[model samples]
Target: MAFTGRDKKWLKGPRAVALLAAGAAVVLGLATGGTVTQAAPAKPKPTHMQVQLLALNDFHGNLAPNPATSSSGNVNGTPAGGAEFLATKLEQLRAAAKAQGQETATVAAGDLIGASPLLSAAFHDEPTIEAMNEMGLDATSVGNHEFDEGYKELLRMQKGGCLDDGDGQNNQNSCPDPKSRFKGADFDYLSANVFYENTEKTLLAPYTVKKFKDGQKVAFIGMTLENTPNIVTKSGVEGLAFKDEVDTANALVPKLRKEGIEAIVVLLHEGGLPADPRAFNSCPGISGPITDIAKNLDPAIDTIISGHTHQAYNCSINDPAGKPRLVTSASSFGKIVTEVRLSIDLATKDVDRLNTLANNHIVTRDVPKDRQLTELITKYQKLVAPIESKVIGHITTPTVVRTADDAGESPLGNLIADAQLADTSTVTNGKTPVVAFMNPGGIRSDLVATGGAVTFGSAFTVQPFNNYLVSMDMTGTQIKALLEQQFSGVNQAANKVLQVAGITYTYNPAAAPGSKVVAGSIKIAGQPLVDGTTYRIVTNNFLSDGGDGFPAFTTATDKFFGGLDIDAFASYLSAHDPYTPGPTDRISITS
Candidate 1:
């Protein structure tokens, strides 16, 4: 028997199928019907809202395109990155999101300025700060480089003020426009972990709560590595305390929840390395401090935007609750932007973590340039031309590059270390230096020599820190300990192998952590290093003060301050008129 109209209304949904199989004829309302009934499909109800987070990190103020042939200028074989192109790409991304009815926020993970090219650095990175404001950066974390000049200068970058030192302190100009002076960043600089010890308060705002049209709030908590003091100049973060990333973020979750906010984001300045280096969108075997930090983060945090390693990758890391969460980093220097589309649960006001998707888009130069950024770059170029155009020296074919080889040594890194050694050796900085060790991270860019002629601009771009030289005396044993640091301690997860001159050694990376260096393989000018022998070492003040986790450097004796690093580099280039690439044989890896 078939069911009648009234019977159909009493039937269940998909659950009705079970009733039908149980025996339909048992109670057919005492009448035979002509047809059987089927359930109509249920209409879908919206459960989430799309929010667009356009992120860029480690944009070390490349206001103009790097030299065409330089690695920094290219991304994945495409001529990419320049402030104009980056601005246009961001505009397109924001416009696309707007067309789709998505709420959008532009954010960065840090290193937005400092170590910039001549155009931006000449004005104390004010142009880059202006550019970031123009591009609409909503907020950013403070990277190690943000403290390059000192926390006071960083505050000035965020709060707008002219340097009291005026125009000539470090070959940089004061505010170009005296009338307007300098307008600080329109974006918020979140520094959750950086606090002034004496005051017991953050140096900047700890986090920013972004409120959208519907009143749904998203909290972005930002912080740099706890090891900041070890990486930045001691003078920069003198009274600031850097807290642990996970602990700091986790502590904020309860506070955010107290305010009924559930969707949370972290703009962390720490980063990781991907096993598959070439793929920006895929993170295979991603490992580093960020991984460990993500693993222990509070489950309430929905996303993590990381930087500092300057490598690109889109990844999904598991939170404390074992739920997959989105993690991303765009390669540095404004070369790429990681577009993250997060779905917020409308009912709960929390992120639908599973519904998130991220992509790292290259800032390809094919698109039309943003006029405003172009004008900014042009104005700065004109201001810096007089001094930047001065020819410093010449370089042979195949200019020295900063790209570290398999052994973690770069031709430019070697050149810089040698230059530092040469400077102190002749000038006699109280202690005559026999060895110079340069921190690889300090070698920012390639010394691109067009027509074999090196200009002050090109040289400055490679070493913009203006870090002065320090000559010190270290026992041979202390020197060995410093080399071991390349693969141990905070560096164990990611290497910071020093670039050296007047030294040769083979390291066995596969060996035990502290025993990577081969026995008796070390030599300084073809002589074995004696444990008790004292040797003079020259390095930039950053390294000499243990800036990169080499505590051994801090243990050295009789520090003698010398000229600026750039001065040594420029003078070396001039003295060596036609600088040639080294044999590049100083470092080696054991089989």
Candidate 2:
């Protein structure tokens, strides 16, 4: 089993390297008569590689601490999310690895930008990009949200385009100009499967080869969900098409193999395992697209870093070849960072030992904030501080936001729907404003009255996406159909709703199928809701695109942009007194 110089050379690639390394270890074992000679057991093969990797995803531009629940649904953590803390952590980890004489790499699985907090989104992800640059990310995959501003905007971020003239339009300096400080991103982007429809070739490099000082080679392929087009706004990715992740990897592996590259990793803009719902500490029970992709990936891929669902976990699964495949994900909003250590056989260059070291650490005041990166964040934070604190309105009562179990609507959801409805009606020439509905998933956080001061920033923290308020007139029959979408059933069980502004309905899960709505509870302003009558409604553009399967909104007539929903919500709160709903009657799906 001993490997000759020629054997080691042949096993240089990542795939065959592991086998060769194993073969050499076997030979060494036999030669030593199953026992190692003196000399401290020859220092044994390293259980981990000298390379340390830190990965994160789904930050959602939460430049401030976000209120997140524990996986186990108990206890509250400290104020833990911000660019300063994230940078601090990344630097600390990198410094530790460097002290150990190992190379460190920081990367993201995407969602590094869009649908961000008021500070980042308002600037069209420039601030987020600046933050990521300071954080030292090496590369990332293009997540669905990256398409929020359309392909041109994506190109702008990638190629360093700007609005140097201080105008928002793409008038001048759209791509690259000689005078601007826009040097583009310090890292690269991978898009193995995404392609231009008109051209079959990949729109971005399928993979990037990273070489370490030890002559070890690692190739990374980045991919987003294959259904990105369906999930994001259509115009955002007009000329692009996404291909299957596994297929793309399979096709690219041979090329890497031919080039003598062995170690391969996937930076997938997908996700896995929820953090312990019972405890906020660690992740458990792997799930989602990443699991499926890992299970089906070619054996050549050694590890997968995933995001999107915003949960954190460290585990390994079996690939199609029956070899162990490692996968890890960090929780969303900079709440956690995953460190994956891979050990490869030096002689054969194949992965032998791989393990996940940590997850779900609070990025709090405890960590030593990196002064350099903190300065960068501080500059932008100061620039947006005034706008973020500008008061929008106030709520007398606490507004709760809950999407646990993906069940019924939350009070915050109701606020968002009302905002959309109010805004839409106010803008349209003669549109009726009967009622509005917001999906619970759209409401990101709860707002406490806390002395009755609410700001524009706080409102954005509730509904941050740039989704325009949309209005439509739907028949009562359509409303009933929308209710059915949230009904649990054998085939369609994942259903939940958010509260509405003016519309009210009751759901009785105990009732027979198709009869869950209470007989007389469906109403609008004390009127018996006629099944055939049309009523004006408001919702976000995401729901209008049939997100979360609320297809009824898509069928409604008279759709138009009603401006920012948060503004309307602010106006509604200003006009109303105290703003308290009757009860938690938004949804009660009984057992």
Best candidate according to lDDT: 1
After best superposition, candidate 1 residue 57: deviation in angstroms?
0.5
**Residue-pair clashes per candidate:** 0, 14
Query: Model 2: which ten-residue window has the lowest total lDDT?
Result: 26-35
Alpha-carbon runs more than 4 Å astray in model 2: 1-49, 67-79, 164-180, 274-284, 353-364, 385-415, 422-435, 439-498, 501-518, 523-591
TM-score of each: 0.71, 0.68
| Model 1 CA lDDT for position 136 | 91
Q: RMSD per prediction, one decimal?
A: 13.3, 10.3
Most TM-score-accurate candidate:
1
What is the model-wide C-alpha lDDT for candidate 1? 0.80
> Per-residue CA lDDT of candidate 2, range 5-69, in tens?
54343322221111212112211111101221111211225644556778888887766554445
* Model 1 misplaced regions, further than 4 Å: 1-45, 389-419, 422-434, 437-455, 458-528, 531-591
Q: Kindly give the stretch of ten consecutive residues in candidate 1 with the minimal lDDT sum.
A: 14-23
